[model samples]
Target: MAQHHKKIYPDVEIAMPTRPRASLGLENGDPSPIRWCHQASPSLSLIPSPSQTPIQTLNLNPRRCCCKCLCWTVGLLTLLLFIVGATAGIIYLVFQPKPLNFDMTLSARFNVRITTDNPNKKIGIYYEKGSRLSVWYKDTNLCQGTIPKFYQGRQNKTVLNVALTGRNRYGTTLLNALQEQQQTGRVPLDLNKNVPVSVKLGALKLRKVRILGTCMLIADSLTTNSLISIKASSCHFGLKL
Candidate 1:
């Protein structure tokens, strides 16, 4: 009965669960944990940044540039010369001289005698009429007439006559007619001796004449002395004997 009374006076104590200790934010020898210190600045982020590449420049050679320039200059000069030539030709056509007026005609004849001993020789006459007269004569072997006995032992003589008729420009024909009269016993001519004789009528002074041989004769006897009037645009007379 005494033991029961003592036990009842003393109360029994109860046990409770305890929490784990914090690591003071430290790992190994470092004060801050490796994972906590922002991963050590993310290990300096070894990722490479976008790199800028250098741009290459293009360069022009001086020799090539000069050659191109030279080519252009030559082309321009050629064009200029062509333009000048065309301009000059046009100016020449705009101005030209006028022509003269006159009438024109051409004629020719031959005279000869032959003997037996002095065989009759043939005569060839070549003549053309224009602003001028071109005449060529040559002794030929062919003869039409029989030789005369009186000139048998003597040298044969022959004569040729040519006549040009046209209106007088200034009496220039007078001199030629006189000379013809003396040389060939011909009458005075009314033709323009100074004027060039042309193949086409009325195309005088502008006519040209060329003769290869000296068988040309102007017979004053066959020419007219009277002055004649004629209408024409121009007149030319030329003599090649």
Candidate 2:
């Protein structure tokens, strides 16, 4: 009976989908609002809000200032040392000082030929008073004398004659030794000179300084009655501060 239905048909009503009334700008008196929503894919519907990561900051420690200060201090000290060394070198090169040399020869009996030399090329010597020279024979001072005060110019050599007279207490002892050594042609004698002098610069005069020089002589003969000649000689001198 269901397959062979009659020709009578039943009537049915269906409603279509509508958009929201608020989207169409409709008033409350209009027809009822119908909301229509699109079907969303479950994999792509949700979206997260925009956000930013916090920025990192840096702070300086106190030790950084100490390191910087130390570096600057070392640099300044090095610069000062260089300057002082350069100044001292300059001063040394500008001034040239030298020592004096005394050379003597036996030209007469008791009259001695004395030669004094100023070795300094840029400085002159002003020989002051209280300067003396002596001759010795066998630990006995044979004769002693004084040199006149004079001004010795730069790089100069002067020759003078001096007479020495003294009482010989050990006359026989000296004569016996002279006779014994004269035959062997090896005689020893000592000469010492003490000089006080001042150096003269361009226009300035320096303080007085004592120079003690000694000469050891080996002679062929040295007799009280006869003259002697130098065979070998050695000299040494020093400056007293």
Candidate 3:
């Protein structure tokens, strides 16, 4: 019996227990790519690739964004224009600049004279070149002259003198009328003026405009050497744009 126990068998291989494959839904015992896919739970979500995303979600929506920006820009410009218009209207209403007031009279010697003493404290006048003065009796033109360009200050008086040196073809008739009027103590004369003048408000000078004036005067006599009295005088004023 001692001899039998001492005897040993040749080296033998042993087998180990394997994990269950049914949990992974694998028909074969070896691991595979399909086996890994089946190993995940059905509730797990799949991540989408960059190219597979929806076009609507990925796009920047340029049309809507540009429309919003354009609308805002237009609104701002409209508001600015409106504000400017309102401001200009207010300024025009507040500062209404007007032409100078003129008073004219005819002398006994058929001379035309004009005087301006600015009645307004805030407005001034600048007389430009090409100003004209004329004297008329009915349809007859008696004298014509030009006024020297000058600036007239506010509340300051300016005087212009013009002589009737021109003689018309009907001078004898005019002379007779003048003599008759002088003896009758009443002379009817018309004074007309065309003046280019710029208006001023405080220190700002406006665009140049044309002033037209007409005056009807009655004097006592036409004597050049004697003192004369103007009995009645009326004037009308207009401006050309």
Candidate 4:
């Protein structure tokens, strides 16, 4: 029996499973010396680091990023405004909008002919409502009218006919004075206008703008029975800005 126990034994050594050792410096830490930018925190917290000196940190998440978002939005808006202003200035310089030209006649009422020359090749004008026109003589408004709504094309000339008719308290006095001036061959009158309009640039339509104008004219007569002719006229018209 002792001879049989010592006869045949196969397995002798056993190995217990163990975690493999880290190799090739993969698990130790980041080896490169370059450090990533650290975000600054508003919390009263302390974190240990190798370098004690306060490094310049980005305030990326300050105050939960609310103030940062607001500042970025404001900066973007300001930049957009500056770009728009520059583009507008360039457009103005290259294609200057010319002032309108006016011609007039009187037949108991004022008949005005206006000519507009738009310079922008891509812009169009749309005359809106709330338009007004007036004629004055010696601090008295003699007549008033309106500019009929219409659309004007780009880089084109447009003509308009406006009739101004009204009555004043000093009609008789004004008639006498007009007759006296007609006798002197110069009947002075001042013409004014305020017209609201919209502009179309490319695919965008702008807000209403006031087109203002003033005309100084010398006429031969103001009576319906007599022939009324404009002698000398000076007119100026522009956008009210």
Candidate 5:
């Protein structure tokens, strides 16, 4: 028989194996430890913030505007006044009245007569000192006595004979003669029937006189007597010796 070796086997555990545990606390069992973490603070610039933009200001000049307005107003007023003045002047000229020019005749002529009554009376004829008688007219003296020369007829009344002539521009002679006659007092004579007689008197005065041509007597039928007064008071005649 061979000698047989006896094998020995190790003993095996009969229970399950347990896992190892990690400790999260200190050995003295204090509160759990705080975890430390590093993080960068947010970066910020120190430059000053942009300054607020300066507010824009609008500029206004009241004095300049007022001056311009005043100048324009004064100019307008002056123009209006000028227009009004011009209009008024034109109106005055248009409405004004026109002046009149008068023309008159300078020369003219008329016929006249004269008479007297005293036979032995010396007659003295006078006229305007500056006026001249007509070329055909003349004056004669009959006697040196105050009365004219004449013969008493069978009627026993003195009859003085005288001849009168009138010829010239009536305007000059009549006005001057009448003015002079008014200054003297005497009676004018009348032309005889044998002599051709032409009588010329103021036409205007005749209507006033209304006297009978052949006689010195007034006609009662006439309307005006103004000429009678004018003739009697404003006219005279005499004989030149």
Candidate 6:
């Protein structure tokens, strides 16, 4: 018989008993309350969190959002401009101020005097610089000058005086015509004047517009240093933008 020797096991390597093999029904381990709960719990980790959701999955489109905002802003600005333009149009229509009416008081050799009246009841006229005053006989422009800028009140009249010199080329012809007209006792004259003006209606003031006046007259003579008589006179008035 072989003699059996007792082995001392202290500090010697000992193999651990093998764990029982998991049942076929259990994937990782034996079933337990904790384990079943952990397996059955909704897959919160697999489901994306709000912060971790894919950018493409969001309902918003960045390009479309920007386009919508831009369209709204442009539409609003267009509406505002339309309203402003309509309001200005209405104001212009309601305030149709009359132009200035002018008449010649004195027309002597190298001297002219004019008087003007504002016809509108509520409209005031403010004349700016760059005015022109001229006299004509038939097709000849005899003299040219400038009128002083001034403001005319409603239904008010203003007088102006100017010294005129004839054009060098036409001085002799103009003098001959004047002498002939004096002998015939009937002289035809044309006067034209233009000035830039601002119109005031009530408390509202408008931008500058041009005031033009043309007068056709039948005069008795071209007397020097004496007031000439006007037999008949007709004037036409207009405004230019």
Clash number for every model? 32, 0, 0, 0, 22, 0
Clashing pairs in 3: none
Full candidate order by TM-score, most accurate first: 4, 2, 3, 6, 1, 5
The per-model lDDT (C-alpha) reads 0.37, 0.78, 0.80, 0.82, 0.37, 0.80
What are the models' TM-scores? 0.19, 0.51, 0.50, 0.52, 0.18, 0.49
Q: What is the lDDT of residue 17 in candidate 1?
A: 36
Question: Looking at candidate 4, what is the lDDT of residue 29?
Answer: 80
Off by over 4 Å in 1: 1-33, 36-58, 96-241
lDDT of 1 by residue, 55-99 (tens): 568898999999999988888888887788777767667765357
Clashing pairs in 4: none
lDDT of 2 at 111: 61
Q: Report RMSD (Å) for each prediction in the order shown.
A: 23.1, 24.5, 26.1, 34.1, 24.5, 26.1
Which candidate leads in TM-score?
4
Q: Can you write out model 4's per-residue Cα lDDT over 1-241, one digit (the tens) per residue?
A: 8887886778877776576634334466857555456789778877768598578877666686888789999999999999999999999999997889654333247777878889899999999989999988868788889988888888989888888887665556667778888888888989888999999998899988998889898888776755568889898989976
- The C-alpha stretches of model 3 lying farther than 4 A from their native spots are 1-111
Checking candidate 2 for backbone clashes, the offending pairs are none
CA shift of 29, model 1, Å? 15
Candidate 3: residue 139 Cα off by (Å): 1.0
For candidate 1, the 10 contiguous residues with the lowest summed lDDT are 140-149
Which structure among the candidates has the greatest lDDT?
4
lDDT, candidate 2, equals 0.78
Residues forming the 10-long window of minimal summed lDDT in candidate 4: 101-110
Across 81-169, the per-residue lDDT of candidate 3 in tens digits comes to 99999998998899987789654433324455667788878999999998888878778887778888888888889887766545576
CA error at residue 14 for candidate 5, angstroms: 54
| Candidate 6 RMSD computed on C-alpha atoms after optimal superposition onto the true structure | 26.1
Cα deviation at 184, candidate 1, in Å, is 40
Candidate 2, after superposition: displacement of residue 227 in Å? 4.6
> The CA-based lDDT of model 4 is what?
0.82
